[model samples]
Target chain A: MDKVIIAQNLSLAYSKDETIINKANFSIDSGSFVFVTGASGSGKSTLLKSLYGALKPIEGSLVVGGVELCGISSKKLNFLRRHLGIVFQDYKLVKEWTIEKNIMLPLIINGYEKSITQSQVDSLLKHVKLQHQAGKYPLELSGGEQQRVAMARALAHNPILILADEPTGNLDDYSSQLIWNLLEGAHEQLKTTVIVVTHHIPETIKIDYKHYHIEFGDIHEVV
Target chain B: MKSFKNHISLVIALVSILFSLQVFTIVERSIDAYKENLAQNYSLVVVSQKTLQKKELLDKITTLASIEQLSPDNVIKKLNTGISKKNKELLKVTLPKFYKLQLKIYPTPLQLQRLQKELLRYPYIVKVETFSNTHDTTYKLLLLFKNVIFILSLSIVLVTILLIFKELRIWQFKHNERMSIMGLFGAPAWLRSAVLFRLAIVDALIAFGISFVIFSYFSSSAWVSEQFANIGISVIVFDKVYDSLIMLGVSMTVSVLLASFIVLGHKEEV
Candidate 1:
């Protein structure tokens, strides 16, 4: 399988004088559903952020989708992001748009035709069982419902890699299971690479997968 | 392809405000000029040699509070010098110092007409006449300059409105940057900026429309007609549709591009 992400001696930090993830190294395969588990401020989200191109590496090399994040053209980074789907802990859906519009946003940005985008959005909305709530706004929906909509949106463009930051953090057990099931569905069907940052990974091991828990400010694959 | 009339109307309102200011100023200046010219040109001229009759006419004139006393010798010299009136105002003719005997008056054309008839009825007044003549190219030149000043004033007003719009757009740029809030589902910068420029064009058209109406109102007034006589007042309104269209296109293009850049450069919320 092709390497979807690579980090070599990747030191991530907010400032020059400090290093949060000190010279870390990691790689994610194209079809892996990897979970990054750590305590609060253990650099779990920061590591995930570096994999995409939000924060730059302070001292080392990092690459995503063949585009070097440490020193890459902004255009190429945008292109890489087009193939990448990201979900924040907060959902980040525009409150003004309907659930259907929200779901089709990525496809629209990727410049898909309206009819095809609608079909894709329809199937995804039905897959997440949000067909009745398609016309509703983000604030109008419950947290579980909103998360499902977000999941659908992330998968709308059918990206090769999907990153989620504590997706089920604030959800109840039932909602958490539902979100995990949605991810599992996407991963299994598309063979899509999935990287999830979570502190609840130990209890979330419902499926066999590789796990990395933060210790001493670095990712160490649990034995 | 929205007919920018709406935006143009709004711009017209802003421009009209400026033009109205210029109009008020022009009216005041024109009034001042009228007053100044009346004061400079007015006098009790006795065109007859009947000394006693001249005295009686002068006496009758003094009875009216609006009239003043006059000297016989002074009156005779002025009536004789009337033949060389053009050269006298030219300040090059060797006319006697009776030019200093002139008195000032601020009367409406009706009042002046009455005065002309009253003075003409006097036997001492040979042929009562007014020196406010189109043949006096000096006054004509001054009138031309006055009109030019008004045109320049209107032009300044227009430029000021355009400048204000520019300033507002600058503020818009900073606002978008500071907010860093994306418009919505991948809407590009041009669509956002186009909304703003369309508003500006509407404003310009609105201002021009209102100014044209008010200016037309003043132009049609009887008083204004008397002031700006046919062929005497050179009112060449320098407004060609194509010229304005070219300016509008350039400004709209520039504003659209500026808004696009500003929106695109804005910091997106993390």
Candidate 2:
């Protein structure tokens, strides 16, 4: 299988003197479900940021979906990001927009036709079990329901890679299980590479997956 | 209700700007029309030793509208009867040719002085009467009025434009989160800020409509017509098509430019 992400001596930082992740090297194969676990401030989220072009590499090289993330132009970065879906812990949905519209964000950005986008949103709404609350705003929904909306949005565009940064961090048991099932479903059915940043991995996942643990600015795979 | 309240500040700013601009146009046009009225009645009388050619005189003084030689019969008739027909004929012959010089437009006191000097340059021209005392007072007052109105209108326009920009920036800040989310999704800058531009355009149209109605009512008001009549000049206070187009253009340009500035600032921050 082709490598979906390759990092060689990668370093991530927010400022000049403070390096978060230093000289880390790793690669993940296409269509693999991978979990990145680390302590708070171990740079797990920073690593995921680099994969989606939110954070640039301060040193060395990082590549995702066949595009280099280091020193990338905004236009090229946007193009790369279009092929990737990102889920945040806080569920960054436009609150003013309806949940249905929130799920339609990716498709709209991808320039999908209205008819197709609406149909896809309708099906995704049913899949996320929020079909009854299509016209409601994000704030009107519960935390779990909102995260499910965010999940449905991430999977809406059929991205090549999905990056989830503690997607189920604040959700309840049912919501967390549903999120896991959705992520697994996308990985298996769509052949999408999934990289999730979390502190723990659930024991209920029934699939072959890889695990990389970040410690002291270094990433190493666990057997 | 909330959306209507949001549009208030921008709409007010646009209205003040457009209203000031229209007032400036009206004042300028009224002054011009009044000057036209004055030019019709204003003329200079010149006594010359020799007959003057219109073309040659025009070459020297370009403002000359028309020159007509004043017949001397009236003055000759006014003379005493002690002068016989032969003497009267000789008196008329010796008298300098009287010519009235009208100008194409009303001249300022300084321009009239310059014209007097230019006319006296020719040895054949003896005396020129410009009635400067009366002309000076009226022209000075008109000029002062025009200057005052121009400064007032300009100041209003500048301050209102600043306020409009501030209001637009506030609107942009309110929508910043939405725009940033769109940007993260690979939407281009223009597409992400489309909401700001749309709001600007919509507010501009509202301002334009309000301005048009206000000016239209003011233009047709009987009091406004009476005031123009009192001044003895006809001024076009509002032109429906032309003025509307200008107001629309100005409001659209200012709102869009301010919105674009806000969008650029947000982009830089991100």
Candidate 3:
């Protein structure tokens, strides 16, 4: 009954001259795993951006975790980010910092003390099976490894919700299953609300997860 | 940890600017003090004659405003007596009867040679001369030594800043990124203004501290500090007070202006 994300008549667009998705509507329940599927330009990523406070809605309303997304200030956006975990298909890790430091970025920006940052980084690294690679830089990590590291960093501050946009879009089958297992494990163990945007729906995994396909520029749940 | 390491370069840059301004103020103040002493003690001559009618010469010399100071008439009237008085005071009197050269205009080093030409024409006048009264050669060499020290001090400072800046930029970029984001986050305009205030105060303190130490050091030296000390407490206090204050005020104002420019460049979009 509780909604983690709610959008009513949401219209997303880049400019006044062009509108991509107009009068869109969606609601995602708390602690539920869902897929956001669409053709190449059906606005799946755009929808995900709106959920995590990236793109502002042009002419409709959107609420994520009780905070309005449209026209939100950067301060509130950062505050909203504290409760959110975002995993990009292309992991946006700082090239200069070590893997551990990259994972600790959100914490550092938020001004977390030095003493607790180490122990916190250690626990998250172990959770993501990345404890050994903590000393390496982002450039040193493979694509799959970098994504996992991004996942670990996103989860570092114990965010309430996780939004993964095309998490397995560029991964091999083995790496893909491993990533799904990690996402599933975090959700089941921590009861974190997770939304995953993926192209492939592998049948081997047994879990109660909803599937939503984007068609005719509208989102519809499919069995 | 990330924020701590970030902005290392910015801090190093700030410290370098601070120290450079410090040494510059010192060297600059010393040069200015030398120039002032050269002007203040310089005398202007209306009449220089071995034999002249005293009452007639008096009418010729009193009209120049720049000639506020003249030798005690005893040097002209009781010339024999004035020489004896100076002889008893100077422990190392180089000459028994050194002509008290009257300066008709303030002579900069370049213009001082004209005194040579004029003295040559006046066959009786041995040489037109201005003498520094102190025994210490250190003050005479103050400008040269400070210039050397300025170069040496800045070389060390630049090298240190280069090393430090390299390490700091690693962390500084991220710190700056987050800070810029924080401001763009619509961190109340008032808070960003607070950062400006912090910048102004730090720059001002640096300028003030440097000027105090620099002015004190150069002023304490017996040869160069004569103007700074005697003018402050003695008869010329009013004459020199404006210059001393101007030196301090300019240093503070310029440093604060530089800091404001840096802070302005960092502000976020409206």
Local accuracy of candidate 1 as per-residue lDDT tens digits, A32-127: 899888888888888877776677787888877777888766566667777877877888776656899878777866789999999999998888
lDDT of 3 by residue, B148-220 (tens): 8788777866785576446434434433443443342223434434544554455455545554555456445
* Candidate 2 runs further than 4 Å off: B69-97, B268-270
Q: For model 3, how does the per-residue alpha-carbon lDDT over A40-155 read when each residue is reduced to its tens digit?
A: 88888878877776678888899988888888986787678767778888876767668998788666655679878888899988877789999999889888888888888777
In model 1, the Cα lDDT at residue A134 comes to 88
| DockQ of each two-chain model | 0.12, 0.51, 0.08
Weakest ten-residue segment in model 3 chain B by summed lDDT:
B231-240
Give the share of true interchain contacts found in each model.
Answer: 0.08, 0.57, 0.03
**Which model scores highest in DockQ?**
2
Q: After superposition, how far is residue B150 of candidate 2 from its true place, in Å?
A: 1.5
Q: Order the candidates by lDDT, highest first — what do you get? A: 2, 1, 3
Relative to the real complex, the DockQ score for model 2 comes to: 0.51
Where does candidate 1 chain A have its weakest 10-residue lDDT segment?
A200-209
Which lDDT value does model 2 have at B192? 85
